[model samples]
Target: MTQSQHMQIQKTVFIITYGRSGSTLLQNMLNALPGYVLRGENANLLAPLVRSWQGLRRSEQAATMRARGTPSGPHQPWFGYEAIDADQLGQDLADVFLRQVLRPEADTRAVGFKEIRWHETPALFAPMLEFLQRYMPEAHFIFNTRAHEEVCRSGWWKTMDRRVVLDQLESAEQLYQDWQAAHPQRCLALHYNDYAQSPEAWQPLFEFLGEPYDAELVEAVLGRKLMHMKWQKPANRP
Candidate 1:
């Protein structure tokens, strides 16, 4: 098959969430699928790429303004900027990310990674997500969340202020809800509290991705613990 055809058939899924949201477990489950390659965190590298793409788009707008009044000259500040194709640059940047960062093998059918730092800047979340959808091939997003109280008590979160962490978690989940409401077909919101113990809970996720749900595979994936701390139910009466 041709390269273009290969790319067209390949799917991409991103696990978007904050830290200690059981994303590593989700990543492991996805990687277990046939011909799938879901990677771990990359310290949120795509954010900077999105920023650079936005900067290029702004330059392209400036170039358009410069074209209306003056004749083109090599010495001009925005002279060659007119030739810059922001859309093409966006695509090129996305391709570089796919080829270099999330390097898929020859037989790979789907590829993506889980990232926890997306909630760091609430304002940039939408733009970053939109950019990915615009440039990536058949991109789908899975917004993973967890119980705020449990999350704030896990890992490094114990070192931070409780109210501040809760606020961030709430803000991030709200962004997920807003985006999912706007584009239901492309987004899936999964809560750790709902699926941490049961492999059957992930059936809807496989259905959303148009993948066959294998119970045994799911069971095996769930059997292995990927996180440093296992999720424990709070002792408070239900």
Candidate 2:
């Protein structure tokens, strides 16, 4: 497409946080803007490599690494210090589906993703994060958080948000926290309780996006008038 006929420059806001940490709520909230789309938590790509990363833990005390040269593998990692294979590169199929189904018009609005298994191995997945950073240069990110206790409680519910909740199968939270602290301005810290209970505190979300908040925009993106879609009552609610 020509520059004049271009869609809104895409801005990816990575919602890197503990799952069930209110990403859906945030996704719903942000997509309300006229030129924004939310690609809910689709980081399944990192599933294969996390195990090997554990072997390298003791070597680097460095914070986060940067992707200096072009990653020479299928993965085409945006930026980071990881041994990636070019064969590892694959487009987020979700992006293709979105462009085709949800955003056919390709509105001038930017799109973003809010998905993670934060309690999982974040350092191992750094390459993917780097790749995204390259693809979505306009991307800013939101790292949503909740007290570990609250996450546990909510995670225990019947319709547990598996994405937000840390499973017995995954790595601990300290690693996630450390990886996060490694990258500063690129992210914002948002708490689930704060976002759920007091929406006003999230004004910074709008500010970071360089847009004004629209009450209507928030409602539509959030699927309107519902606080926490009662998913089979979160596993075991009375």
Candidate 3:
């Protein structure tokens, strides 16, 4: 499809979390919803696209500087890609995502993906987050987190240093917190323990996404283990 053609995205939802943080379980529950479709861990696909965009801006800046007889340096302002029409770019991105990463099903009402790697370096994820925000202003974000000690004990962190793991988790939590603070209407901060202890905790999530709460589906999803990480109750759970 041509970039000029517009894609009408009903809703765009992003699931953001660090590894072994019950993100996969949340993904499963979100996927079970009637209108939402979220793909898991597409960092391999998304990271390249964002980096390529950065590269393209650098190249564009160099060429523009050459044309203006100005020396381009590392300190030059990043080109904003303002030349590209916002709506067209947004639609083109949607097309690329749906076609390449997550193909739309017949009844797909909302589309998005989940990735844990973004939490490792939230700074690197900033440009991509900005891209999503600018293009899909209506997009909703779910910031999922698990207890620090519990995450450190998980198999995913077994080989890693506990201190480093804790720091990374803290950084991830802070990134999400900042985003939520800045755009409360567009983000939801959810803890894995809270959701596990009471499945009804997902009511806020469903409300955030403008979806009907399906108690039956939630119960069904909870009945079985969807992700490899088993539910771990936190020490401070009330």
Candidate 4:
């Protein structure tokens, strides 16, 4: 397939975060902008797809190493890491994402989704980021975070989901930091507390996205009674 066939979207924006980290709010805000529609989470599909690919690579590595009588030694699981064709994997994943996750809309100049599982599946971040960088040249990433304690206290965590929440958040943050360091212009790190305190605090994000900042739209969406829990902070208090 041609390179453009694999990367059909004009611009792809990913809001990567742990659950209960205000990614939905970020999505809503971005969607309010003209020609931008950042959809909700798709971890149910993305996580399993990524895990299966990793498992397949590991299984192949084990089979190959055993057949060749090669000692796996300390890095047994990643024994054949170098043998994996990342470019081919990238192409496959790009096709999967375009087919499964994104919804095509002619009016949408940028189409994207928010996914929380990137935190739990930290190993997939680098490869996926590389793939995104290669295929979707105009891609932007928003790494949203809330306070660690706040996340732990949130409903999502309190409901018996044990995925090493803190560790996952830390690892995800590190991934975001590393990616942002390399591509400063295309990555944005945002804090839920800051944005919740003042929806207008997201002006920098709008600026980074080259979208006009609209305080009214921010207030309109944020002021409503939504399904998600209230941010519990005074609006414009900060």
What lDDT score belongs to each candidate, Candidate 1 first? 0.82, 0.54, 0.72, 0.71
Candidate order, TM-score descending: 1, 3, 4, 2
On TM-score, the leading prediction is 1
Question: What is the C-alpha lDDT profile of model 1 across 1-238, one tens digit per residue?
Answer: 3466347437899999888888888998899998888887887888888887788777756667566865558877666666667799889888888888888877788888998888776767888898889998899999998888888888677678999889888888888889899989899888888788888899989998999899999889888866556543322212
lDDT per residue as tens, model 3, 66-129: 5665454556574433343434644467557666676656666777888777755455566667
Question: How well is each residue in 75-132 modelled by candidate 2, as lDDT tens digits?
Answer: 6453344443222333333344335433423465666666556445455556545555
What lDDT tens digits, residue by residue, belong to model 4 across residues 1-238? Answer: 3344434556788887777787787888888888776777654355555555556555765566567766555656666554556457755776667655676465667877887777455677765665566655488888899998788777646554445767766787888888889888788889999998697788988898888888889898787655667544322212
TM-score of each: 0.89, 0.60, 0.78, 0.72
- List CA RMSD, all candidates: 5.5, 8.9, 6.9, 8.1
Ranking by lDDT: 1, 3, 4, 2
* Global lDDT of model 3: 0.72
Each model's total of backbone clashes: 0, 28, 0, 0
* Winner by TM-score between candidate 4 and candidate 2: 4
Best-matching candidate per lDDT: 1
How far residue 204's Cα lies from its native spot in candidate 3, in Å, is: 0.2
